[model samples]
Target: MSLANHLEELQRKHGDIERQIDIALSHPSIDDLEIVDLKRRKLAIKDEIEKLKASPTTH
Candidate 1:
């Protein structure tokens, strides 16, 4: 896949994770660890996006 396409996918994943976190927060029975894991995954995706954006690319 192209770098642009990959980046777009990562962004989509980040957004999805954010939504998951929101939904998870709404339920009192949800495990805190699960939420934390989701947040970490989101942050990791965000970091990857930033790294890709920071580097000069044709995309």
Candidate 2:
């Protein structure tokens, strides 16, 4: 796949994770560990997106 396409997919995944975190937060019996894991994954995806955006090919 092209670099742009890969980056888009990663961004979509990051958005999905954000929604998941929101839903988890709305729950009455939310699991702290689960939310933490989701947040961590979201951050990792964000970092990867930034890295890809910085690549010469992406520009």
Candidate 3:
């Protein structure tokens, strides 16, 4: 797939993670470790998106 398509997929995953985080937070029995892992994954995806955006060919 092209860089643009890859970026879009990553963004969609990131949004899905955000939704999961929200749902987890809404639960009274949510595990803190799980939430932290989810947040870390989300940040990683965001960082990747930024790196892709910064690539010369992406422009």
Candidate 4:
């Protein structure tokens, strides 16, 4: 897939992960480690998206 499409998919996945984290926190038990891992993944995806946007596009 193109960079734009990849970014969109990343954003969508990030949103889904965020919601999952929210729900996990609301429960009687919360996994801080899991949340941390998810946050790290989200940040990585954002970084990749930024890099893709910055680089020159090729046809």
Top candidate, metric lDDT: 3
lDDT of 1 by residue, 1-59 (tens): 99999999999999999999999999999999999999999999999999999888944
- Indicate whether candidate 1 or candidate 4 has the larger lDDT: 1
Evaluation by lDDT, superior candidate among 3 and 4: 3
Best by TM-score: 3
How far is each candidate from the true structure, as Cα RMSD in Å? Answer: 1.2, 0.7, 0.5, 2.2
Judged by lDDT against the true structure, how good is candidate 2?
0.96
If both were scored by TM-score, which would come out higher, candidate 1 or candidate 3? 3
* lDDT accuracy of residue 55 in candidate 3: 90
Taking the tens digit of each residue's C-alpha lDDT, what string does model 2 give over 1-59?
A: 98889999999999999999999999969899999999999999999999999988776
**Whose lDDT is higher: candidate 2's or candidate 4's?**
2
Clashes of 4: 0
Q: Ten-residue segment with the worst summed lDDT in candidate 2?
A: 50-59
Give the least accurate 10-residue stretch of model 4, judged by summed lDDT: 50-59
TM-score of each: 0.94, 0.95, 0.97, 0.77
* TM-score, ranked from best to worst: 3, 2, 1, 4
Off by over 4 Å in 3: none
lDDT of each: 0.97, 0.96, 0.97, 0.79
